[model samples]
Target: MKDFKVGHEIGKGKYGRVHLATNKSSGYIVALKILLKQELKHDKLLRQLEREVEIQGNLNHPNILKLYGYFQDEKRVVMILEWASLGTLYAQLKRQMRFVEKQASRYIAQIAKSLKYVHERHIVHRDLKPENLLIDKQGVLKLADFGWATYVQDFTKQVKLNISLKTNGYNTHNTHYSHFKYSSSLKTICGTLDYLAPEMVKRQSYNEKVDVWALGIICYELLVGVPPFESIGFPLTIQRIVLDEVMIPDYVSKEARDIIIMLLQKDPINRPSMEQVLNHPWIRMYNKSSPQNSTQTKLTKTIITNINYNNC
Candidate 1:
């Protein structure tokens, strides 16, 4: 704490609050996320916290929020993070109601590229939504909050090795086994209820494809203002996700609709990979380099100017 000067609260979360701070030496500004030790222990989230640090610490991608470092005192754990000057995508979405096709496509493409990077590393981001996406001053979208993310190994390769072990008559009990170190699909039912994929709704094991499913939902929400499966309550929403088909409005271009349909497939096997999502026609069309930055910066500044800075 001595290395910096903390300012007024900038954001709040379940764990604690985020404050705008500055490095005393370099004068670098950062967002300081302070998680309460007592609250973390009471919620039995110590292991989750450790995993969050481990997973997010190693991640390096332009579209992903940077976790500079972390320090702890007796009662608080403070994480130094990249400052997102434009606030969250959720707030912008709330104010604008919905985004145009071009804007939505550009944002989606960035998300796909970032997710592709993380998937290549065998990590899955269980929770993905506008609330967890931050926008920087330059209008760059960043993925944040890796508390529910975890590493997953290829099931086929591990299964083949396990079969070899059995054939050699080596007692499996003699070998050390840990799901955290090695796993095929993850079965834990975590993440927001609204964005739950079909397999997740059914309480079945799911892979990184779950993030692709969420990408579809986010795309839909970005263009339509609300999630496709949103219903009166949790049960109805679960039913919609499991049994109902997505109905993209006719106003949405065919290419945009096609990408959304491809992503929201009920079966995980049917959904496109993150690479495919990035290469989708709709994404590739508006994802052009030159126009994206200038347009995004203008739109972001316009929207941000309307937001009440005091609350943020």
Candidate 2:
């Protein structure tokens, strides 16, 4: 950790502060997220933190944040990461209130592509929201914060998959679902209330479809200028999400609106997969905005060449 000289705090997270730092040898700037080991141990979150570091380190995609590497001392867990100069998606949305159809779709499409990549590896990001998304200097969106993620392969299907999302949006509790059978896993009511699918609300066995619901909410917020379930309190908001009625503002393009509607479907199985989302008509609109796909992958990979990982 001494190799990187930490600087003034640039941001704060739930359990830590992010500093603008630089590597002494390479002179490369990075975002350093410092978490107190004591707090994590007290909260019984060491496993979650370890899991996050493990997951982020293994993932590599143009639309996913780069984890350069990490090491922990007795008191603190420090992560050196690629700095997202443009800040978080939440900040950008707050500044402009919303994005035009084309701009919004471009971000969504990129995220969808990344999610597809992860899902193919049996990982589920239980928490997905504007604040968890960051924008780079190139305006490319990348996902961050994997504390709520879980690898489905590690869990057993022999037990019923009735996972109940707890209040924090990070933990889940076990409950029974009488109507369901078979297995794929990822249940227990995870994710934010605004983004929870109806099946999750009912505490039924769920899968990656919950992420699609969250992505749809993001798409709606980008175009409609506000979260569909914003305002009111948590209780009322939860009820509205369960009802599954989201009004796509008239200004949203019909194709864009249709995708949002489909993504927000009350039935999880009915929602489009991330692969389907990438191919959606709304996403196709962004294809011409960027250059050929061949160069895109190579350029993005080159940008994070300093990052080293064991699993990926």
Worst 10 residues of 1 by lDDT: 158-167
- What lDDT tens digits, residue by residue, belong to model 1 across residues 41-82? 532475566667767877877788877667665567777787
RMSD of 1: 10.7
For 169-284, candidate 2 gives per-residue lDDT tens digits of 44343444322122476566666787777787778877777788889989998887778977588778878888648877677888998899988988887998887887888888
Cand. 2 TM to true fold = 0.83
Worst ten-residue run, lDDT, model 2?
A: 157-166
CA lDDT of every candidate: 0.79, 0.74
Candidate 1: TM-score?
0.84
Off by over 4 Å in 2: 154-183, 289-312
- CA deviation > 4 Å runs, candidate 1: 42-44, 154-179, 290-312
Error of 1 at 188 (Å): 0.7
Residue pairs with colliding backbones in model 2 are 163-187, 163-188, 164-188, 164-189, 165-188, 165-189
